[model samples]
Target: MLVTAEGAVRIWTINLPKAGNAITGADFIAAFEAAVDAANRDTGVCAVVLTGAGKIFSAGGNVREMADRKGMFGLPAIEQRYAYVDGIQRIPRALARLEVPLIAAVNGPAIGAGCDLAMMCDIRVASERATFAESFVTLGLVPGDGGTWFLQRAIGYERAAELTFTGKTLDAATARNWGLVSRVVPHEELMPTALELAGQIAENPPRALRMAKRLLQESRTGALESTLGMAAAMQPLAHHDDEHDRRIAKWRSA
Candidate 1:
């Protein structure tokens, strides 16, 4: 994993493209945890963009490891369950805890667990070469990582169900049509577009951006009244922030 910052936007690139960028056991989890930790520690970082090196975004779980019955996949049924809960599942959980907005720049195939990874991001921007699939069924396994939960929420239950059951892949255009990705661009333009969007998000007051993201996340599972109460409570905090006052003063002078 390689993490670099472009101003207030952090870019995290998964660098194992030779293996189709497959995520092996604890490596991915540790890298992601570190990246999130770094972002949290850096007050200047307001947004993040995640992408892959080389041609493929990610192939998801390590298929070779699964086929050889090695690593996490080789454990006993109960042990396997625990491994997923304690290991691979950490990626989504870590991402969920992030206050800054995240954007996925899908440069190529994002299959199986890879698809779930993109779904965890707050926004997805795909290259025209990008393809997505909830391919667990093809390998005779279920979505061990949070694909089931994220996929349905991304493209709706019906569409997610069909893809999961069939293990079919969708092109960038189809994914955009299904609301899985917000924008599709040429392969070379993927990161630039994602960074441009991230820049826009990073321009906002950091505290307000984090609070707004928290409110949106809460609304996903919380009741409407509960979300409204949170918004009401958070609004005053934003109003009192120095960044808010500075921006207001600048706007009034203009």
Candidate 2:
């Protein structure tokens, strides 16, 4: 089930059966993409919180389906492999595109692609019981999803290489220490804390928040001079908004 809720905040929850919640192929990806588009278009929504409903956040891909596809010979196998990688890559890339602040309320084990999904979010607040691992190596696979990119940027190449090569699992606290997660909370408090953080972000001027997100993302790859030029271009757009006046007046009074 893909659940979407609206308020000062928008929540998108992915609920899959206990059997396994592997994201299958293009159909599942389309549905999630549509959900994201709808949420972004919603003028009433200021921020979004994503979480999974179950003991595990997501199992990554359907193992049974993978086994079935692997048996098919020749070009079919190669096509399936590419399709699988494409499907995996889309999930995290979609999160990175969200205009509003994205909060990952991690509830449990986030393995492989699941780990990639959480890491893609702007902020990650995890349940105490939550565990994260890049288990691709364990399965004789390289990180196919955006994990390779996210891990390296979030913690640097050395740490990302270490984690991926060993396929080591980190508890919430250790993940936080490694800068993989923003915060860790008691299991029962995870959702509430994440919502609170989302709510606070929601209260900020929307345009400014969006620009800030863009600037930060741009700064990651762009030179300082280029970032400054980008910010200069963005300032005019922000100044014309109603929120700008309110901020200027508030600052003047202060």
Candidate 3:
């Protein structure tokens, strides 16, 4: 299932089980962008949750695909291969632009691109069995996509470097300690907890929530003054909405 919906959260499950549920080619990116667009267009959807169906979260790219002799031998084949890799890598940035909040429900192992995908989300709730690693270097590749950017921001530059350089595996507890995942719950409780969290977010005013997400995302590359201006500019628009008025009236009456 590339995308599934439950209540207010649209779940995107990585579906390439042929390679141990790995995301291989351009099709994965196309599917993801479509899912984000669908979720964004739905008035009922207030958030998105990304997870892996079945057992493994994802095993990054298909190792066999990357090691194809045809692709390595010719310029055209190499270019085609690169295009495919590029599309796969762009999934994180496409996900980053989604209007609503994204929560990663890390049910199991997330290595390489799988790990990067989880980190790209605004929040991550991991199962006890979940594990993360930056195993790209072990495969003789650097962290592609937004992994370096997100990881550095997530766990600081030094730690990100260590993880990238050493290709070390991090368990749920260690990941939580380094601020990779926001919370860790028992395996059975993972989906419920993530859904509950998504439901809570859904209860908020949708426009305001999306605007807040935009501001936070923009803040990453936005200038400080511009961010401040944006926040200041957005307040009146959000505060004057009917949802705000009703919620405030309820609070005032209380």
Q: What C-alpha lDDT values do all the predictions have?
A: 0.92, 0.79, 0.83
1-254 in candidate 1: lDDT tens per residue?
A: 99998999999999998788886558767988999988888888999999999989999988888889998788999988898899989998898889899999999999998999999999999999999999998889899888899989888999999999999999999999999999999988988899999999999989999999999899888999999999999999999999999999999999
By TM-score, the candidates rank as 1, 3, 2
List the candidates ranked by lDDT, beginning with the highest. Answer: 1, 3, 2
The window of 10 residues in a row where model 2 has the poorest summed lDDT is 66-75
lDDT of 2 by residue, 28-101 (tens): 67777777787678766788888888877766766666556542112475785776557666777676677788
Model 1 CA deviation exceeding 4 Å by range? none
In terms of lDDT, which candidate is strongest? 1
Which scores better on lDDT, 1 or 3? 1
The reply for model 2, stretches above 4 Å from the true place, is 70-77, 252-254
lDDT of 3 at 71: 37
Clashing pairs in 3: none
- Give the TM-score of each candidate: 0.98, 0.91, 0.92
RMSD of 3: 2.2
Residue 74 of model 1, lDDT score: 81
